[model samples]
Target: MGKKQRRMEVFDARARYYPSAKLTLEELSYWIAFSRVMGIGPVRFQLLLDHFQEDVASAWHAPSYELTRIGLDQRTVDSFISQRANIDPAHELKRLDRLRIQVITWKDACYPPLLRKIDYAPPVLYACGQLTEDDLHYSIGIVGTRKMSSYGRQVTEHFTKELVKGKITIVSGLALGVDTVAHNTALDNGGRTIAVLACGLDTIYPPSNYHLAKHIVDSGQGVLLSSFPLGIKPEAGNFPARNHIISGLSLGILVTEAPPKSGALITANSALVQGREVYAVPSSIFSNSGAGVNKLIRDGAHPVTEVSDILEHLNIHTVPLPDTSVLREPENEEERLVLALLSREPRHIDDLIRDTELAPNIVTSTLTILELDGLVKQVGSMQYVRCT
Candidate 1:
């Protein structure tokens, strides 16, 4: 299909999903205009809304004195006035429409629920793909060092795959290393992911991930989310704010791997401040890549050894459909013993060994048999669960 046709379809889909009654298109244009002003952020934006009785168009046209009366400093008022003169609100909205981007304001019912609870959540979001209900509710933020070790890569893949199996959506920054692995694993497993960008959706930073970003949107399984306005470039200062959104959208933040100085720690910290759970993989004490996660665990972050650690703590219960074509009863006591220990919650092999008191070989062999009979499934590294 032609690019224009695809854009038209996306626009139509957005209209269907986000029909606005409280904020008309004209009012939204003013919101977009204010978002573009340099000095106005969520707090100031809210002040304007409250002072103007939620009429953003009125706020936009308010004189400098009125802006000052609403508590905007003289510098901010000057910036707003200077920018507002050059910014045509209608043209800004038209530009977004032309770019196939959808504007999600704080007033929209379709705004992410978790994000709305944050202290200073963005007043506006520019999204490039569909944001589903699943993305809003069942999301886990995966972040780690950009320079990942081989161990980091393996750990990220394992947790991501298991989370996807549990029907959880992955949220990440779309940076290299752990974020990339989490996004790709979720997609490969036929699950959804959300890529939160520091820059505007118009520009995919790190440029290398551009194709990955395209695939995410084109596959219809994920979204490209950003709070920055159109034409904004990726800046170093933008990342800390970007990290906040990643954690805000997720039920918890998981640090699969990271060094002590990794930016991923910033995200974990944000998760804590947001009153969200923080999960970290325990790595070797001697490994430099493990220092941040180890510190997190020491500071009371949940240490994840298996997928069940997250699922159980978060109270997320996922039951995969049984493979009807291969249903069979356990033919032996060993198979029955292993099957008895397995439930919808993933159990590590070591835990089963201790509980079953069976020989390691016996437990392994019995699990193999049960899996072949479609009675049990492995959700992660050496973690098994009942099929039903």
Candidate 2:
């Protein structure tokens, strides 16, 4: 028998055994196969599912005429036919099993409920770590420029720590800069996080974050998520599609810092379209990095200066804190000097050196000591600021 005939036969045999909401192994394989198709995205895939009576396996093996009738153009139908002819659903599942990547269909109970409410919610997600009930309860999508300023870093870390303390699950695109800081700060605070990737779960895009990805998976504190199947590379076009999932999965989106027309802006727009709240941290008007954020604030995004702003907007009560709001007295002359030089605004090491007339080594060591004592935080590039 032909491969299409074989697929139909298998579908027929399992037709009586199909569950109401969950995908069978064979069904999941077809879902994975559908994810690999270029022209068939969330909306087209949904059309196929509905046309096939929600049997994705049957839809996967649907003939060209049926696909064209379901609104796929000739070119797209041709591509889908050619791609389907080459992929093996069973072998794809085996590859996923080998990589330890887990697949969840839209019908799965564990799928993000908020994501399901979106118009083009991903039909399937490939994840590298555990996704639990709590992750869905309260999630904040944090996004910003890959070229983050020290001030952006400081703000991201501060708010991320506070969110974790409030038991909010942090979500981000797993890009560089703000995304990395958000994930690390959440993990550091012993809270859960979820990283939605622009590529497949098998490949960590940006490569530098491979160790961080592994830590998230192995530590069970976060999940690495993607809508693409295995072996998909992080192409430029993939990220705009990826941004939808980030916003779709979150309760709201926080744009820490972005330049005009940045990818983070795309995510914020997506959040607004999805009816999720968009929050922006107001930044110095002089900084280019803050331009997008300031515009967002002007556009009526909730302006957040502190974590309480976010918590208040979300109506989540903060956990009680110990009484340690006051800054500690400096232990020595060097510590006193470092404290005197630092302020709420982030200052780079070179600036400290220029102002203090102290050796760079002394400045660096003092900043490190101050950071360890929770009196200071290193934002990036040897920049330091007082921890509020």
Per-candidate TM-score against the hidden true structure? 0.80, 0.86
Deviation (Å) of 32 in candidate 1: 0.9
The residue-by-residue lDDT of candidate 1 on 205-305, one tens digit each, is 77778778888888888888899987777778999999999999999999999999999999999999999999999988999988999999999999998
Residue pairs with backbone overlap in model 1: none
Error of 1 at 313 (Å): 0.5
Which lDDT values do the candidates have, in the order given?
A: 0.85, 0.82
lDDT of 2 at 53: 89
TM-score of 1: 0.80
Clashes (backbone N, CA, C under 3 Å), per candidate, total 0, 0
The C-alpha stretches of model 2 lying farther than 4 A from their native spots are: 1-21, 69-72, 318-341, 347-368, 380-383
